[model samples]
Target: MLEFALLVTALMFGGTTLYSFGFAAFVFTALPAETAGPLIRRAFPYFYLFVLATSAVAAILLIARDPISSASMGVIAVTTVFARQVLMPAINAATDSGDKSRFKRLHTLSVVITLAHIGCAAFVIIRLAGQS
Candidate 1:
């Protein structure tokens, strides 16, 4: 279970890091802006869900072996919930309402939250590797 937890945590870390750093940029560069924007917006929910589920399970599995790591994962999971459920809809609403400033602000918030999640997942992975 510990090994599985570590694998999941590593996956979360790698997935987010890769997507944010490379894939998203490649996507926008390759696709038309109108198409890419909506496509990325559509993909965000699935990305958040992956973070939420993986982090939640990793936290549960880490609780006995490493309480602090577990708590960090929990924080990531909770933040993802907010990013997915609350912030996302608000962002979409701002876009629909043609409020460019509001959309940018909300989008920035979402990006920060995702980066924080990636950082937390990386911390957990480092801690786990140290234990190995």
Candidate 2:
């Protein structure tokens, strides 16, 4: 079970890291903003869903062995729900309405939320896998 929890936590960490640093970066550099923006917007829902589901599963798996990690995953899951349901739509609306300030504010919030989730996942993985 610990091994399985570690795997799931690693999956959560790896997927977010790859998407944030790898896929998103590649998309923006490879395509024009006009092309990349919409493509990423289309993909965000799926990404949020992936985070939410994976973190929720990790939370359950870690609940017995590591309550702290489990709670961290739980927070990641709940926060992701807010990101998907509320923050995402507001950001879209801000973009559509040409509200640069609003978009900046909301987008920054989203970035912070994503980074926090990644940090939490990383911490959990390190704690579960090994001290080193």
Best model number under lDDT: 2
For model 1, the stretches where C-alpha displacement exceeds 4 angstroms are none
Shift in Å, residue 69, candidate 1: 0.5
Question: In candidate 2, which residue pairs clash?
Answer: none
Worst 10 residues of 2 by lDDT: 123-132
How accurate locally, in lDDT, is each candidate? 0.90, 0.94
lDDT of 1 by residue, 3-39 (tens): 8889999988988888898888988999998998899
* lDDT tens readout by residue for model 2, 25-123: 999999999999999999999999999999999999889888999999999999999999999999999999999999999999999999999999999
Local error of candidate 1 at residue 58 (angstroms): 0.4
**Model 1: how large is the Cα RMSD against the reference?**
1.0
